[model samples]
Target: MAEQALANLHTDSGMHGRKAERFAVNRASRILSINPALSGISIRSCHLLDISRVGATISLVTTIGLSDHYYLNIMGTANRIGCAEIYRNGSRVGVKFIKEIDDELLHTIVRGDFFTAAI
Candidate 1:
């Protein structure tokens, strides 16, 4: 039987350095990457390793080798979750989900061009 294909994401502090300083959670809100639809010009599924309202770390495996770039559909919302490059071995590829619990900036990134998944 062929191996099933799916993906996941994970995240935490220190994933990104100065670029990812903690934002104040004054009026806290939860950010989730749902709507991983298999549509759109560039989109793929990933294993969500970890995530905060902001962003997440994720893992994906492809029988074919990975390209330096790709987009992530966070499995629920129409929003296309962003991703940055990460290590890869054989069919396994890793990336950081780009978004946060914060609303404005998060919307900005997703609303604009897709960026590398920062960690």
Candidate 2:
């Protein structure tokens, strides 16, 4: 089942029993230009279902045309984290961050302190 797969991806031990702790963020954000050279990098809206220092689970309307690597722009901040696709099921995607984010930034995102822009 889809729910089971998602749970497997988001377990406290994480996708493969990794160390970083994940937070249930459910924050709105965007995928910035999956392939810039192909179409000048179009923005696609998505939601951060949860996040950790090393990766995140995202939900979008569709996964069509999404790339293996891209940047995730958190809605309320100027931060952009490089991501590499790990898995996909229906509207949900699992990605591993190219570089782990700092704890302060992770806390800020989890606390909803970033400046979110109008849709």
Candidate 3:
């Protein structure tokens, strides 16, 4: 399912072109905390489809009521990124980080090191 979403995004005519290369991390299921600092409402689960330093693609059960801005918590690590919605298609959403994440953290996530941090 995650792979299909990534492929759809690539084929989607609306893509403006990506700023950074994305790394496939479909094996991880991370948590999406909606405006955590403000509301503390967290979605049960969302899969990390692909990621880059600037943004990521997540798979959700439903996009309903999702705000334009939210916080994504990378499950196995103490990392939370502020994200702004770029686009949503069915259950997939493309988001851009409010601030770029460092390469070390990006590599850590791509390497699947956070798997041990998952609860």
User: lDDT tens string, model 1, 1-119?
Assistant: 01111112233445454244322111111222333373435334555443345444455445243445455554434555565556665544445555434565444433332222321
TM-score of each: 0.39, 0.77, 0.70
lDDT of 1: 0.41
Q: Which segments of model 2 are wrong by more than 4 Å?
A: 1-18, 34-39, 113-119
Clash pairs, candidate 2, are 76-115
Please report the candidate that would top TM-score against the real structure: 2
CA shift at 50, candidate 3, in angstroms?
A: 0.4
Q: Candidate 3's residue-wise lDDT over 14-51, tens digit each?
A: 24664465676764555555564666676647888778
* 1 or 2, greater by TM-score: 2
All models, RMSD in angstroms? 13.2, 6.3, 5.9
lDDT of each: 0.41, 0.78, 0.71
